[model samples]
Each structure stands twice: as C-alpha cells, then as structure tokens.
Target: MSESKALCTDTELFAAALFQLQVSVWERTADDIPVRVEDGGTIERITPVSVKINGIYYVRSECEFRVDRSGIKS
Candidate 1:
C-alpha cells in the first residue's frame, strides 16, 4: 500500500502556521469584541496590525467578515 502525503505545499503550510501564530498573539493581547453588522451578521476573530505612532509602537486588530444574506428579509 502507498503512504499518504500532505496535500498542501510548503508555502501554504508556512502561511497557515503564521496565521495561527498571529491568531494566538491577537487572542492573548488584543481586546477582542464581536461586532454586529447592520445586515444581520457578526464579525469575530482578530487580525493584528503593527503601527508606530509618535515613536510609540502599538498593535491594532482588524476584522473581516462575510454576511449571510439568504436569511435576510426584504
């Protein structure tokens, strides 16, 4: 019998690992809040961004979400 192999490329695996690390840092340091969309959806999960303001460094979190419109009423 042949052995199974990983389906993802090396670059893909590295990107996934990096994303997990970012998520860990965000969870530990960011003040995460779930925001409700006007179209009846929720935005969760934090993505950290680094910024320097007046020589001070800070980490800011941004969110990206998709809304489900199928259940919305017209």
Candidate 2:
C-alpha cells in the first residue's frame, strides 16, 4: 500500500510540486495593498506576466526552478 500525507508545510509543498506550476497573474493596484517582499515593488498599473515559485511563501518573476525534496523520504 501507498502512504499519503497532507502537505502541512507550504515551503515543502511548493518545493515538491507547486513550484512547477506556472500560474498566470496580473497586477491590480489597490491603495490597501499590504507590504510584502514578493510584490516586486509598487504595482502602479495593470500588468501581466508568468511567475514561478521562488521560495516557501515567495515567488519571483525572474529566477530558476528550485525544487524541494524535504517532503519525500527514502
């Protein structure tokens, strides 16, 4: 039988599979935008681009694929 586990860690889950999924995102400016490092800076106008997962809770418009295997055990 195969065993399964709920990916409790976002970091681990992203590293394993979520990172590979290219999610199309558009920039929508809002005055109430919260401060976050992944925002890439002020979203002054509507923009669209392909983004990739760069870290546990971070994604970068420019970066390489970094897969995490911590969730998998041998």
TM-score per candidate, chains pooled: 0.19, 0.24
| Residue-level lDDT for 52 in candidate 1 | 28
The residue-level lDDT of candidate 2 at 27 comes to: 29
- lDDT score for candidate 1 against the true structure: 0.28
Candidate 2's TM-score reads 0.24
CA lDDT of every candidate: 0.28, 0.32
Which candidate ranks first by TM-score, i.e. highest?
Answer: 2
**Count of backbone collisions in candidate 2:** 0
- What's the true lDDT of residue 44 in model 2? 22
Model 1: residues >4 Å from true position, as ranges? 1-7, 21-74
- Clashes (backbone N, CA, C under 3 Å), per candidate, total 0, 0
Question: Which lDDT tens digits does candidate 2 get at residues 1-74?
Answer: 33233323445335445334222222224664423234222212221332333433223333222222343455
lDDT of 1 by residue, 1-74 (tens): 32212212334224433433211111132456544222221212223443222233334433222223232234
Give the winner by lDDT.
Answer: 2
